[model samples]
Target: MNKKQETKYELILNAAFEQMKEKGFEKASISQIVKRAGVAQGTFYLYFDSKGAIVPAIAERILEEQLGLIKSEVKENDSIDRIIDVLIEQTFKLTDRNKEVIKFCYSGIAYYDSFQRWEDIYRPYYLWLEKKLEKAITTKEIAQRKSISHQAIFIIGLIEQSAENYFLTDEPKKDEELNLYKQDLYHFIKRAIS
Candidate 1:
């Protein structure tokens, strides 16, 4: 896609994201998204076949943003503790900001066969974590795992689930409580990998 196409694509995506967040994947309509995007309905069809088709695209955009943040904030030479702290902090903030979109993408992807590309969308983020694990293992910073791939997935599952539970469910936490939770999570992950 060229620059204009990219802009229109993003507009449609942002519109879809807002609509999905507000009305959910089941209720958000293609008409609503296109109308909100100020684009022709045909324009949306040019980018996505159906409402469900947008899920992986949304997931890709969100994960790509998160990966960018991770790469910029977490240094290669950072110690394990620093790495954990940064990951937890950054993941929590991202989850807090985009919890609804995250929730929508998780559910929305399941209904579309094309969303099988979900794993492909997430592969880069997973590979980045895997590389971190490999480096840690080589430096004796974390225990050697039989499969670094599984280890990376486990770490991501833990962090994402915990963030969802903490930020997306129940009552909100105070700053001190949130800090304690982060500390406990950091220690839990540290011990598990060590």
Candidate 2:
């Protein structure tokens, strides 16, 4: 796409992101997205077929941002425990910072098949973690296991669910209680895998 087209494309996506944040994926409408984008409705159709069609793009953007934050926190020589800590910390930080997007994605899963495309968007993170776990298992850093795929999936689910529960939930939590929960979560996962 040329510069002008690129600008319009970004405007639509950014507008869609904002709409999804405010109204949620299921309720966020194409017309609102186009209006917020300052583009004609026809322009939206040029880029996306429906509101649902935009979800995979949003999911990809959100996951990429989270992965970037996680990668930034880890050093080349970090130990498995340290990496896990960084992962947890970064995951919580991202969820807290982008709570609306996280909530939209989670809630969208209940309503939109496009939301299930997360597995594809998350493939890189999954493979990266799987490779790390495979090495750990081989070196006996984590317990030797034949089911690395299962283990990797468990780890992903653990982080995603825990972060959503603690950081993205509407439920109120006191600072002290939240800290304790985070510590407990860290220890629980550490013990489970290490």
Candidate 3:
């Protein structure tokens, strides 16, 4: 796609994201998204088939963004413990910032038939974590595991679920509480992998 098309596509996506975050997936309409994007309604069809179709795309985009951020923050020579620290910190911040969008994506994908694409959307992030786990095992930073893939998935689940619970729950946690939670979570993951 050319620059103009790419720009329009992102505009539509951004508009949809905003709409979904503000009004939720069920209530957010295509027309509203197109209007917010400043594109014709037909243009939305050019990119996405329906509102539900955008869920996976949005999920893919968010995952890609998170993966990029995490990769940028982590260095090649960093120890596994340091890597876990960065992962937890960055994931928490991102989850807190995009809690609404994350919720919308989860609910939207859950209700739609596009839920099958969920694994595909997360595959890159999963593979990245798997690679890290493999390296940690090679370097003796973590215990040798029969299934590095499962370890990666478990680590991701631990970090993401903990972050969501801390940030998205009904009761808000203070900064000190977040610090304690992160410390406990870090040790738990460390012991599990060690």
Q: Per TM-score, what order, best first? A: 3, 1, 2
lDDT of each: 0.88, 0.81, 0.90
* Per-residue lDDT over 1-194 for candidate 3, one digit per residue giving the tens place of the 0 to 100 score: 99999999999999999999999888999999999999999999999888988988888888888888899998988889998998899899989888989898888888677756998787788898888888999999888989999888899889999999898888956779999999999999999999
**lDDT string, candidate 1, 118-191, tens digits:** 87887888898898889988899888889999988888879878988998886956889988998899999998
Per TM-score, the best of the predicted structures is 3
For model 2, what is the error of residue 134's alpha carbon versus the real structure, in angstroms, after optimal superposition? 2.5
* TM-score of each prediction: 0.91, 0.88, 0.94
Model 2 residue 41 distance off true place after TM-score fit, in angstroms: 1.5
What is the per-residue lDDT of model 2 for residues 1-194, given as tens digits with 9 covering 90 to 100? Answer: 99999899889999999998898777889989999999999999898887767777777888888788778877766677877787788778877887888777666655577534777888888887888787777667889777878777788778878988887667888889867877888889889987
Provide the global lDDT of candidate 3 against the true structure.
0.90
Candidates 2 and 3 compared: the better one by TM-score is: 3
Deviation (Å) of 28 in candidate 2: 3.0
